[model samples]
Target chain A: MDLAPLALSLQVAVLATLVAAIAGVGLATLLATARFPGRDLVDVLATAPMVLPPTVLGYYLLVALGRHAALGRAFEAVFGTPIVFTRVGAVVAASVGALPLVVKSSRAALEGVDATLVQAARTLGAAPARAFVTVQLPLAARGIVASLMLAFARSLGDFGITLMVAGDIPGETQTASLALYDAIQEHREAAALEMALTLTAVAIAILYGVGKLTARSARGA
Target chain B: MAPDGDRPSLHVRARVVASHAFALDVAFDAPPGVTVLFGPSGSGKSTTLAAIAGLTRPAAGRIALGDEAWFDADARIDVAVHRRGVAYVFQSLALFPHMTAAENVAYGVSRALTPEARGERVRALLGRLRVAHLSTRRPATLSGGEAQRVALARALATEPRVVLLDEPLNALDRSLRRELAGELREALGQLGVPVVFVTHQSEEARALGERLVVLEAGRVTHVGTVRDVDDAP
Candidate 1:
């Protein structure tokens, strides 16, 4: 069978993981540290995608990034291409699907850091930014890494949202999961079986890496 | 002006209203010597140190180091923790776990001193604290007393105007505590900065405190020289 679907899936998931790692870790730090009115509400909203149905998330994304929508128009103005049915669309869908995993796990990691340690750094003449980079971030790094691995695995398996936004365009938008579905519909059982095994192996390897990272963090703590 | 020419004093007047259990309503002045905040646990001794170090904001107070105003609630001037130029040796000995003893001490030294000065200061302070052998070791590898000395070296590396010791020796065994207490006293004497030493142990207070300020339930019960407190009821 063609390997283009597998390549496309890898590209989408890698880009999505990068996006989630930066934005998700930042959001997690904010949730773990800052306190203000309705902070709990914002936290719930950030993690809602995890429990919400993938189709519902896809529908919302479609509405928000539709060709005529405000945000979609702005993106088109800059890129001269609509987000819908594009490779970028798949990346966005996978990133959203993976975000909750990163945020929830990384938030726990950040909170596990001792408040007294942070205070000690401050009183030792370290500014807030310096303390975070030198102490808090390093202390929480293992947990963040484990969570990112889980997010990458989750993004690779994303089907519903990716299908909704990127659609089936072979060698472009059709990711491995979408290709597997197409192979099954066309009665190509061998191709479907190969894709399924490949996906399963990739998922298992990622999950095994995540397990090792978490074990290391627990021992360090 | 101080009697010793331009030698500036540290003045702290704070009224921090927390719950009855943790509230702090106290004030005292410290010259260039060890002034112990002697009290039992939960008597707001640590709170007072935190307020002076800018880790805790007081409800109404003024904290000044010489002529520099660190915090003044009425005047609405509160310096950030780093800018206050106050160093602390936390009771927990909050050493950076990722860095070696030398790196931890070097952190503060590198911030304020030139590169050459930082190297010299780190070497001298670590040698003084007797942690020169453990310079490359992480905090987890060090013993409790070793960790405490590393914390002290890190604090002193900044050459702070004030040093706050929040029960730094509490975690050690009795003999180790006594030995380190003597070393700490010597170190403080050489540094020439006003030290706010917090301790619940009466022996430590007597051993290190030139002046004693007693606290009970968030209020200053007595403030005097060590002899004055010992002579009182």
Candidate 2:
């Protein structure tokens, strides 16, 4: 009857999805629109997480958010909160794991928008910010939803990053995936199977919802 | 000499480099009337319109509207599109799909007005263009004529020093084209500003333009009234 792991999993997933979506949309904006020196380099770096194994990302996050790391120590000194082995740390790991999906989908959505629509806004006396908010963003709203769904689903299944960085402290940092893994190792076959089935069902439902939105029904709406 | 009066005039000299492997060297004067630029497809008529509207930068030249320079490469000053004292209605109409007809019209005047004034101005524009009742309709719902008029009203809403229309009548069928062409002519004529409009059809050029510039290839072949064009090939 230990529900702490399940609660921690949900909390980490929600927080990670939020952080990844924000960063991904911002990154997508740059990828789809901005022209700068070394733009390709930034694109590669942002997408690096996608190609990396979750374990690799976890290892990096472990070092980056750990006590001795510059960022971790700076946080402890300035904000009185250390990320490692904490719920927030689990969130940070999950966001890193799911970032690629958000970035890729958001960029595609932005690129699919009509540039002429942007020009039309300009002639209508809209500044760049106004044009983006009123025209570009709405036209690409479908793509945005796709990004969110991908990030949310991926974050929900994040295990390696959480395991490596947050260290499976049941009530404090152990997410659903880590708990399932732990249950399997401890020979709790029924519990592990149930958790696995629940995660799979959630993932499938989210994917089905995204498919429905992309169908003609959402366009007419 | 021409009549001495206060009327808007735009003198534009521009050399356009083709996106492909050619250059469209064009220059013309639009002196406070509907000066039609007529040419076959790819003859650089649109290039000239784009240059005047500040959409395309000329390789080396100058553009001035009523004694004010819009682009002077020699002086290294090229005004950006929104601040060029000109309004351009592109061939595609390029309406914002998400906005209603009234909102599209209101968008231009919105930046310069209080909310109440913006609403009134949009309504007046829609009424003048005879699309007042269709204000709530999205662009996808509007007919070709309605959309064109909405674009025209939006362009003219700001009272630009010059109005540039490129193939404004090409999108419609013959009957609608002729009907809206009249409305288009009235809109341009009523404006006390320079209008350099472009078209490919000889008939449309003759009907709507007070002055015509016929382009052959990438050069100006003739500049005169309809009779001059009729007497040519």
Candidate 3:
């Protein structure tokens, strides 16, 4: 019942959330606004993770980032370390699992923002980047915050993907979920129950935050 | 020579197929005074303004202020919306919900040399629009008239070559619209820049317009001085 796994889990979840939020929000904005050819295809690709099995996602990551893969070789050669079976790998897996939640929710939020506000910003001499930062992003913030929190929760509870790619390395890749699984197997019922309760508390907090955001956005509309 | 020999004129000849339901073919010349785009709903008044502002692309023809072409379909010149230096006051106000009225006004003055300069510009515009008291308030807290003033202040802070307003006071009550209309007209007159104000109300058009361009089903049905249009056979 070491505390190391708990700390690692928190770190992985936080990093995963950060990564997912930045990339997911950018993708969401593109999906919400841009109108190039094959935009629908790009949108589907971004959101496919929501429906894809976590194990399948992990399997694809493993194929592309495995020690024998060219990308894995280049990464190891540059960094002097392998990405597979590392805590970073757990973060990668968790982020992929959580990304679709951020993308979908933030896209919906960005779309809900009145186009007139963005148009006003443009007409008032603000560039596209400036307009988005000043107007659209601020207006869509509630939904973005809701989506990020949901991503964090998803990353925290991720099991199948983390297990497949990062494995169950003690004090490194052994996140709280992995530790809980181990505790149950080793007959440490108390440790298993503690980890389960902790995860449930985190989930409830995130759900409450998301609920408030949804209500606020509803009121705004 | 034409009157106002050196002053730039906004000359627009745009034919835009905006959507399946709307197509706009309009041509007009506006000097540095309020030229009202008078029309009922769905008559492409807003679309015409949007085209001039570079928010909408024309299917053909050109738009120029003096010699500088804002858009020319044949020449392949289309200015970016923000680079066009045109400000718009939307019918919906479109005030930034997250910012105070002061901040919203400040956003239009990106070329201000310093923070103090930006603050001064915002103050001057808010004062001119008589919404200085609402500077610290968010748009949601402001009354419709106050919000309209803030929107006007935001538009003017850009120091734009032209200001386009889409039914700027339509959201207010009848009394408020009437009160603000007079103030808005005075304020716009003092700026000495071309103002394309859109309105469906004939009275509002007559009250605020020096020149009137009447649209019907996306076509310019009439273009003349307000008095001339009113007296037309």
- Worst 10-residue stretch by lDDT in candidate 2 chain B? B1-10
Question: What is candidate 1's lDDT per residue for A23-123, written digit by digit as tens?
Answer: 89999988887888888997898899899998899899999998989999999999999998999899999999999999999999989888888888887
Candidate 1 ranges beyond 4 A from true positions: A36-38, B1-5, B110-112, B227-233
Task: State the displacement of the C-alpha of residue B210, model 3, in Å, after optimal TM-score superposition.
Answer: 1.7
Model 3, span B1-233: residue lDDT tens: 12465657788999999878778999998888899888778999889999999999999989998889999999999999999889899889899988999999998887646988888888888888888888999999998988998998898888888889999888789888888889889988887878899988877877898998888898988888776555422
Consecutive 10-residue window with the lowest summed lDDT within model 3 chain B: B224-233
TM-score of chain B alone in model 3: 0.94
DockQ (Cα-based) per candidate? 0.81, 0.53, 0.86
By DockQ, the best candidate is: 3
Sorted by DockQ, highest first, which candidate order results? Answer: 3, 1, 2
Candidate 3 TM-score, C-alpha based: 0.94
Q: How do the residues A144-195 of candidate 2 rate in per-residue lDDT, one tens digit apiece?
A: 8877887888888888777888888867887788889999999999989888
Worst 10 residues of 3 chain A by lDDT: A212-221
TM-scores for the candidates: 0.94, 0.92, 0.94
Better of 2 and 3 by lDDT: 3
